[model samples]
Target: MEPDFPLRKIIHVDMDAFYASVEQLDNPDLRGKPIAVGGSSQRGVVSAASYEARKFGVRSAMSSVIAKRNCPELIFVKANFERYKEISKAIRQIFYDYTDLVEPLSLDEAYLDVTINKKGNPSATLVAQEIRQRIFDELQLTASAGISINKFIAKVASDYNKPNGQKTVNPEEVIQFLEDLEIRKFYGVGKVTAEKMYKLGIFTGRDLKTKSLEFLDQKFGKSGNHYYHVVRGIHTSEVKPHRIPKSVGAERTFSENLSSEIFMLERLEHIAQELERRLKKSKIAGKTITLKIKYSDFSLQTRSKTLPYFISDKDLILETAKNLLYQNSLENSVRLLGISLANLNTERKETINGEKEVSVQLKFDF
Candidate 1:
């Protein structure tokens, strides 16, 4: 920790059981019962489950079939992405009211740098409370808030109390708060990584702080340095605003693999249309069109072509992707097809000669 390092006031806000809570809010009947938002089909994945559903071993990303087996009384509802998006925008507007320094991790979670807030509220904890209250009153949603000196500590504090709760970790309490934390509770430490740390006798933050930086780096590569600092309540990452679009893409795995070029072309066209819509929304055009294919045996291939002039035309993108696909000539049945537009531009430029000259280049890897 460097002296004179400006003390940052960071707040991490996380919506509680976002999807399921939204479902419950819309329907009075679902308020107290276990609810999950996803298809009930055998191949369906659980996108979100309520706390009630979680008690029965239900979890996000679990197979719906398995969730049903675990809790026979589980109620499954279709996912409403549009509704979630609308709510997410509303919540974001509230964040902007306080500070422009907002970084969204997802629709349900964000980190806000409120070191210099609009309200001139000296206490970060009060700011967190006010924001949480505003979210509930305005959006009818419950959010958990954590206020700390840095992003890492703030994120952990938010989870300390969930479902419309808040926790503040002041500078004096930072070290003790981290020292007692479970190794698994540390950000970026997954199950396998936690197990490895445990094997090294590092089960708590104190255990982690005891290790030398060189030793930890030797064990965990680049991320070891991060872990070394976070255990001591040190983090320097700033909350960056959402970046402008550089690429737009969509990919899907087929239920049954198809070897037919016609079927693949149809799928590619659909993905191209999706990309076109996103590009139009962002007011961006890209010069590179990329085609990605995955075979039934799990082998993958990518083909890309870069045009001299950026374009957002769906027809042009689809045609270029189709040509790239044929050029790659599949040797096996294709299980997945994806198309992407990259190397974006905000506006087009013209030469003095009044000629719309453009260059195109292709790159591929087998």
Candidate 2:
């Protein structure tokens, strides 16, 4: 066995088809049937899909039209974020009972470092099983968990026996487990990165392990170092209790594409109002305002301007967005409009003279 690997007992718990499962739990009629949680309108997108819907290739972020076409009888349910948040809070409470080092990735997933949990239980595997069972018993929702020495492996292992199961990658097996895994299945390797890896003849963790750090750095930059470390079971990120937001934004897709700026004024105003409300809810303000434009032909464009002072008012956001809108000629008819704020107040770091220095977190460093 490799001697340097940390012996922490980390578990990644992910709720199975969370939003869809919540809908099914509340409305029994939707159980065991193909359902999507989102609108079925022309411009709507699927936020979640049940297991039955997944069988037909219906997935989150898919267009409503394509989802329905994929599953002819797919039922569309409007999303209830408030209910999801309530359940998420309850789930966090459950985690707190076991460990204080709990890190939530989203409403449906979290990482628990149970190496020294409150339960006084030594076996991480058993703790995972008990947690899964408790969730089912209390919330009537099934969750899957992955247990390993670190966050990356645990996150990937969680999906091994999904929907209602857990997988544990023991310390002795960690190296072999990662080496034998498919490159595409690595947690951070998305479709684009996987394709790039395939082009470079990196098909699996073993293949990735063969490359020199210098070679990887040249090809993939800093991410190459992360891959070089993780494939050898070397991810060192701690499970953080407070996950900060990188940006806040709101967007709306129109039922009918608008050709003229005059026709989009009202839509932009409403979007600004929504964005302002979100900023206030989070108690956040930002200096950078970005306007995202999605054309009818599916092309995307963004315009951003940074301010000297933080602002979260609807009027300011709307005015800045309008300026960005008229800053350039429309490339094509607009199908979607969005407003975002970044360089957030939350990102301020303590500096000398009682001032704050804004910093950006390196997201690619695993």
Which predicted model would earn the best lDDT?
A: 2
Off by over 4 Å in 2: 1-6, 348-366
Quantify all predictions' global Cα lDDT against the true fold: 0.83, 0.88
| Candidate 1 accuracy as TM-score | 0.75
Leading candidate by TM-score: 2
lDDT of candidate 1 over 8-115, digit per residue (tens): 889999999999999999999998898889857454568899999999999997767789988888999988999999999999999999999999988899999988
Q: What local lDDT score does residue 169 receive in model 2, on the 0 to 100 scale?
A: 87
lDDT of 2 by residue, 204-313 (tens): 99999899888998999878878888887777677878877879999998888899899888899999999999999999999999999989887889999999999999
Every model: Cα RMSD to truth = 11.5, 6.4
**Which stretch of 10 consecutive residues in model 2 shows the poorest summed lDDT?**
357-366
Please list the residue runs of candidate 1 whose C-alpha ends up more than 4 Å from where it truly belongs after superposition. 1-4, 243-249, 253-269, 272-276, 283-366
Listed per model in order, the count of residue pairs whose N, CA or C atoms clash below 3 Å is 0, 0
